[model samples]
Target: MQEIIVSWSRRRADSPKTFTRRWKWTREDRARIEFYRTELAGCISSATFDAMLEGVNSESLLPFIFCYTVRLKDLDLGFVEAGLVARSWFCLGEGFENLRRVLGPGPRDEGFKYIEDEVEGEDTGYNDPDTEPDDIYVQEQFLTKQMPAGAEEEGALWFNVNIGAPGNYLPGLRGVIRLQSRSTIYQFPLTALSGWSAKYIAPLLFLPNLQELEVEGHATIGGLKDQFYYPLSIPLQLYKGLKSKVKRLSLVDGRMRVDDYDALAELTGNLEYLQIYHTYRYEELSPQEYASIASFFRKNNRSTLSLEEICINDIPGTDMVDVN
Candidate 1:
């Protein structure tokens, strides 16, 4: 069996001054090599490419059979076999972006159908009843850069762009693109939280295969002293736009008004799990407000709601009490 072992990190003992040549691949490394060589090699070279194309029409299925990383210089036969893997996913340093640019235009130009349906006869187990959807990770900046030019036009807030458009390239090339549960973080700029959420977060709610979502708000361009703020209307708009597709939701490090609780109570009927941590800046909930929230969950108890988990925590200075 052919094997390729790569080790990018060096321990202090592996330094030049160590003088003793004790460096060797560990047992775990050998196992990884074997798995890649035997199982993954065949799957990538043939199966993954066909799956990606079929996924374009199947909204519930993800196109990627598996995700793996390879180096730019190492785009050998084996590397090309690993379809849909993000080049930046495994790069050792800063040059991955440049490599992405070099590789980007070719796939876009050939139009995702370049690979013929040679592997369609293979039993890739993509349709196994027990199979789970693949998880796609997308950074906030990456998501923003891909948004269509008039994405926010006509009060639509969010809608799917054409597959040929630069912003909508990923779905066309990779297929339905399901995101990983809890692992994928959807970040929005703290400086423009309301506007960003309106444009980007709205579309995410409609993703056909997305079941869980976690959103983090950070100030990439400013300091925390900036004290991010948004009206109750923003989150209300977000909750109103959410489809029944997502069963779990988490929001972190953002601010919403006290009245947003009414919106939350109205929106969470279809949710199975909900978590709000340090995301709201409202004053303490009045007795009536607390009762209203409790009533919403209590009313759903005898129904189909699998909403067994709910958490709400406020920032330190905010007088809001914890909700279970």
Candidate 2:
């Protein structure tokens, strides 16, 4: 599933323009079109995008736009795969920005550039060695610099230019594009983003109106420790920095410690619903952690306080509330 960011001022999901679609046709196909259209549209509109998706039957139409609600203003779906039903659902939105960063173009060399390694695929290791191509390719890469552009009301807000590679210099390539002004979601694969530190992830905090943030990957929550040390702390800080007005937040196969939960509780005081999944045993907290958790709930309790659902994948016991 993907994360969506919507504005607080945006119309409620129940509104017609925000969730419905209309198309006209002649009497011949009107009954069939209207029937399927109504049924498909209602299925999408009835629940939040993250809810379990109903099967899309229209293979003839552009599956992307056909399966999703076109009325949403802006959304941010993370680590989206190619050609899946959900991926098509994302393409329906106003924008679909890709955020996977690639190594910049290789270096510029006036002299003859030599190819040392064999190409990974195919019988021939060489790429027409005689023909001089337009671009140079670099192999070894280091993080030399990070240039952050100011938040623009339109166009891409952040872009990274990678400069060097192993053998040759290629033209720098730009990655991590953000089209913030448009009411659309950004989508990319989780594996595409292999090594991201707080520095790379921190600026997302500036997007105050972000309605939802979703990350998808196969790495189980317990495996997060293998990816980065102190994994939960930094993410917790970013969550805290997020504007409290955000209604929905999701982390998939990402580590969440008890303190992280406390941090989320602290930041999203107005949150109506919250969920966590694919994590380790959510054992009852030790006495100290329990106290801190109690403090968190007390401080962030909503007036309606409709639902507070904490789901841990590997926990052993029944639900227990620690008011101590």
Strongest candidate by lDDT: 1
Each model's RMSD to truth, in Å?
17.0, 19.2
Whole-model lDDT per candidate: 0.32, 0.30
Worst 10 residues of 1 by lDDT: 75-84
lDDT of 1 by residue, 264-317 (tens): 445444566655565234223444444445445434432433324554552221
Error of 2 at 65 (Å): 20
- Relative to the true structure, candidate 2 reaches a TM of 0.37
What is the model-wide C-alpha lDDT for candidate 1? 0.32
Q: After superposition, how far is residue 203 of candidate 1 from its true place, in Å?
A: 2.0
Q: For candidate 2, lDDT tens digit of each residue in 1-324? A: 132332323222123233211111234343454465456553222221111111111112322232343333344332222222222222333211110011111123222222344231112222242332333321111101111112110111111111112221111111212212121222222222112222222233233434544442311122223332334355445345443544444434433346655654655554444444442333324545544554454457455223334333322112434542
